[model samples]
Target: MSGIDNLPPLREVIATHDLAAKKSLGQNFLLDLNLTAKIARLAGDLSQSDVLEIGPGPGGLTRGLLAEGARRVLAIEKDPRCVPALAEIADAYPGQLQIINGDALDVNPLEHLTSPIKIAANLPYNVGTELLVRWLTPPAWPPFWESLTLMFQREVAQRIVAQPGGKAYGRLALLAQWRTDPRIVMELPPEAFSPPPKVSSAVVHLSALPAPRYPANPATLNRVVAAAFNQRRKMLRSALKSLDPAIEDHLHAAGIKPTERAEQVHLEAFCALARSLDS
Candidate 1:
């Protein structure tokens, strides 16, 4: 266990600071430096990129980012107790680790960094999916961040990269795959974290595309996908009945078979339906 700066073991820091992972915050601190460094590598070369991290519980991943020579790291952590713990790292790094003791969802992180940003975090479980969706759905092409390397529960990781015909495929897969290439790079057992979570976790790295893989109205595409997946067991014609009077026409126009179910439809086909709906 190589220390980032002889900063003492994470277990000692947590114990000394009286910092216990708060259940309310969905906090599960990862203590292993080996694993955290691996996650940092998964984000690619951070030396040229500024990084934004959410919920840096105990500063393990934050240390990883800094040690890997990220240009700088801005960590937003909601837990007040972890502020000083992270501050210690900030001092050790001297101008590299910038911390915000605020809710990540409420704060606009893009305001802080001048350079291209890469986000890396072992996200708190409660808001992980919501935050990811927010990051992926900006109206303009090429979002503020260059890439996102985030950790989520294993199930959620699968959902982000899952393809059609897989049960894990749904809104997340469509949303992530539409504008970015997301893949699960590493999987961790429950024991990997302090106060181990009940389920396994995985790290997903998403590289942004200059534009969406296909053309479609974002609003229309989201609505169409939501409607179809909400009634996933039903055929497209039946599930999309609420979309418009010409649901079948839209399907046919998009070259999609009306008999297909949501789980069977691909991202390209969904984009087609969204485009057809706009027509």
Candidate 2:
């Protein structure tokens, strides 16, 4: 039995169920209970929060969330083969665990979760970035979840928390840093998973700010950031000229140099540009 609970160890569980990590699904099952519990702890105190977990293959992290005392856990697994294994976890936790066999991208989790929600997952590789972008760019401020504790390939994690003037600093850095306080909280080698991904992974903890770091319309900010980074090598004036006839004037108004490339500009300056464009 896994030390964290009465449930069978993940390897045994996977073997019994004939559950192999499928490359198409981007499944790399994290088999260590201790590591899973540590990841759950990184989400902070879950005693009062309902957690929404995506792609919970073999229920390893689900058990950790439960063993760590989450008030409720809503797990969405796309693979039907893993549902029965998760069902066993639900049986052990009684009412605390709810398993939904559906695609996380299509399913609206707000329906199953309560207020003061937190999202914790070893997210599927294929859909991780898309899901994160959707969460970060919601129409409203102070989104459905209070925080996000998620695992991503190290490169992607770096992009999420990257600073200005780095190769990793681009649209993702601006987007995540604009609305949330994101940091890399842990790193794992490829061997940490069952089949093991080619790239190393890291866990990012993002606490949603009460409001954006600076004021800019979300749609405008996204558009401006996307445009700037799409041709990052070109000077802002040249690259953004298509955006407006007087793009240089807007850049000057936002206190940005017209000749600067996208990577050289910081988040605040980008927000200022968005505001200038909105005006």
- Highest-lDDT candidate: 2
lDDT of 1 by residue, 28-136 (tens): 9999887888898899999889999999988989888888999999999999999999999999899898999999989998788867899999999999999999999
User: Could you estimate the TM-score for every candidate?
Assistant: 0.98, 0.99
Which portions of model 2 show Cα errors greater than 4 Å?
none
- The C-alpha stretches of model 1 lying farther than 4 A from their native spots are none
| Range of the 10 consecutive residues with the lowest summed lDDT in candidate 1 | 1-10
lDDT of each model, Cα atoms only? 0.93, 0.95
TM-score of candidate 2 to 2 decimals: 0.99
Over the stretch 1-279, how does candidate 2's per-residue lDDT look in tens digits? Answer: 779999999999999999999999999999999999999999999999999999999998999999999999999999999999999999999999999999998999999999899999999999999999999988888999999999999999999999989899999899899999999999999999989899999999999999999999888888888899999999999889888899999999999999999999999999999999999
Q: lDDT of candidate 2?
A: 0.95
